[model samples]
Target: MCGTANPCITLCAVLVGGIDGLENKLPLVAGDCQREVADLSAEERRGLRVTTKPHISIDESLREFQSDGALVRGLETPLVSAYVSIMEE
Candidate 1:
């Protein structure tokens, strides 16, 4: 099933990528929509490359979530961990 089929997985995956991007100081790439992203040439798309792991399993995503710097300040680690654990099940 697609990740979007599970809201939990979808949200967690986005969070993982966002955290990684922040830590790496990745630049943002603006695409109007899926069509705009798809219309870009291979070279153009490469410019937006933040991570090679475009799709990851929930388990992989959880590992990132459990990492020391995965979440930003103000987000309680215990709560996030509990939430992710429930989603993984």
Candidate 2:
């Protein structure tokens, strides 16, 4: 699944299965770390090597899935306890 060229497929799989499905494939970073990335200045974000423009708008694609009933629910709220646990480490 990780080798697929289409990121949307990967995202859809993750969305359907929840984050636990990614436990082996990726590290579980704290939600605060994610928020910090989101809060980064545009210039700071652009400086991150992993950042790239999506070929299609992910929000729009997700909306299409919602309209088609492919996605049963929206994303889960960030796990604050998980963040605290990470901080304690």
The model with the greatest TM-score is: 1
TM-score of each: 0.47, 0.22
For candidate 2, what is the TM-score?
0.22
Q: Quote the RMSD, in angstroms, for model 1.
A: 5.5
Task: Give the per-residue lDDT of model 1 (tens digit) for 24-83.
Answer: 898777443354543556766666662243334767656765674645232457766776
After aligning candidate 1 to the native by TM-score, how far in Å is the CA of 24 from where it should be?
10
Candidate 2, after superposition: displacement of residue 72 in Å? 11
- lDDT per residue for candidate 2 within 1-89, as digits (tens), equals 11322466447546755544464376543232254554566666565643633325444444443453223433322332332234334
Per-model CA lDDT versus the true structure: 0.59, 0.43
Clash pairs of candidate 1? Answer: none
Task: Give the C-alpha lDDT of model 2.
Answer: 0.43
Q: Where is the poorest 10-residue window by lDDT in model 1?
A: 47-56
